[model samples]
Target: MNLEECRKEIDRLDKELTNLLEQRMQVVAKVAAYKKANHMEIFDPRRERQVLDKIAAMAQYKELAPYLQKIYQCIMDESKNYEREYMKL
Candidate 1:
């Protein structure tokens, strides 16, 4: 395809990403509730490691692992913030 087509594809992918992010946040809200009820901490190192490992294994390019990890880190940080707010802790 042409440049415009590629750009449009990116736009479409971005829209999908945005939608997924929103859905993930909703799930995070539930997680916050669960954690609050269970007296769990916001930061779980083992879960983070497992998530990163799974994401890295699904990577199409090994070079993208670091970038993907950073992205997930930021996402998880936001989720933690949400959890804190939800639990008022």
Candidate 2:
């Protein structure tokens, strides 16, 4: 494939990733709602550790694994913050 075609493919995949992230955010919102109803904490250290451990083991891209872990950490941190704020409502 040409460079332009590859670029277009990457753009399409990026858009799909954006949509998937939004969907994940929606799921996190639902979790926030449940936590609010149950008076549970927004950030669970055990759960976070489980996620990190699983990601660390499961990531196939050795070169990009650290970057991916950083990305997931940021996303989870933001998600927890979002849940904290959302629960206040």
The best candidate in terms of lDDT: 1
Taking all chains together, each candidate's TM-score versus the true structure is 0.88, 0.84
Tens digits of lDDT, candidate 1, 5-88: 999999999999999999999999899889889988889999999998888898999999989988998998898888889788
Lowest summed lDDT window (length 10), candidate 2? 61-70
TM-score of 2: 0.84
Instruction: Provide the overall lDDT of each model, using Cα atoms, as 2-decimal numbers.
Output: 0.91, 0.90
CA lDDT for candidate 2: 0.90
